[model samples]
Target: MRLFDKEKGLFISGPEKQISCASQIWMILAGVTDRETGINIIEALDHCPDAEGMSSPYMYHHRIQALIDLGLKDRAYREMHEYWGGMVNRGTDTFWELYNPQNPDESPYGGIVIHSFCHAWSCTPAYFLRKYYY
Candidate 1:
């Protein structure tokens, strides 16, 4: 399985050469590398200069799981609390399909009308917290 970039110090997708948080998180989930290496890859992703960032709750969930797998439970839990709590504080009864704190109104579609406020995928923070932290 192809993994990281020796030069950029992050995971890279083949063919397109695009580096993404999803690729790195999936590699960690697959258990194909050492824990130290996985943590390094995750740290690299945290500090990566990539403009894509995390585009979906699906991707963020993976990143949180990766952090937990790497024994960064506090970091993972803190992220979960902050991320989901932010949504809760904003008056959301259910987790959103996508949430970007920097842009509260951000949407994958052309407008906010198409956004899913109660996405199933976005409900995993409770599971992560219960499984790993609580």
Candidate 2:
């Protein structure tokens, strides 16, 4: 109840004080929300119009899992291609620790020089795609 903002139809996160993505996905995975509410929350994940979508592959992995669990695999697959595909298009041989297409060179540590372009958590699609899709 507290996590959702009914008026805006998004999580209570971002500049107005919402958390990032992980908890909500966990809630869905843990069976905390009823099916419809879980679906709505997962569908409304951007948090706010001004919010940049989640940047961490760890968080994206959680979202992907929630989508898979909720039977929203097409959306999950599209999301993977759009986000991780951008990495491929950039000629990357590995996944990144963090990426935001809006700020392609962003690094949580401060600069691109410190970024982990090959973050292990970013390899989730292999496991998920194989298990769920094939």
Candidate 3:
């Protein structure tokens, strides 16, 4: 794989490959390389199938939010549909707790503790898109 470093940040690419859960989360927020070629974010999730299944709702929600920021409403809405559809198939209750979160009174942890690496990488586009696009 080839890695590129620019003022924006670091990016890696090549024939499809697996990245650590930490790195995958980073790339998502950082935005995939060569978006013009239509590198779908969904493709990256394949590397973390368990995370995908466990956190699909959050991931999809973030993607939709990112799409909206990119002014890709059509794509965002389509993803929303797919997300809800997947929830229907997978059973919404199975993942609802992660979204709702819980207090100590309710549970030991409050909501899912998604790593900071995941947050920074997953949300990077919303923060740096103008640098790359505008």
Per-model lDDT: 0.81, 0.78, 0.41
Residue lDDT tens for model 2, 1-134: 77667765555655666644676688888887777887887767664454445778888888888887888889899988888898899999899898887788877787888888788899988988898888
lDDT by residue (tens digit), candidate 3, 49-76:
4431324345555555556554566666
Candidate 1: tens digits of C-alpha lDDT, residues 1-134: 35568777677876978887777788889996789988888777778787257756788898898888889988888888888888999998899888888787887688878898899999778788678767
Top model number, lDDT? 1
Estimated TM-score for each candidate: 0.88, 0.83, 0.36
Predictions ranked by TM-score, top down? 1, 2, 3
Q: Give the range of the ten consecutive residues with the poorest summed lDDT in model 2.
A: 44-53
Q: Give Cα distance to truth, residue 57, candidate 3, Å.
A: 1.7
Best candidate, TM-score-wise?
Answer: 1
- Model 1, position 129, has a per-residue lDDT of 67
Error of 1 at 19 (Å): 0.8
Off by over 4 Å in 3: 1-10, 13-54, 89-134
Q: What CA root-mean-square deviation does each model show from the true structure?
A: 1.8, 2.6, 10.5
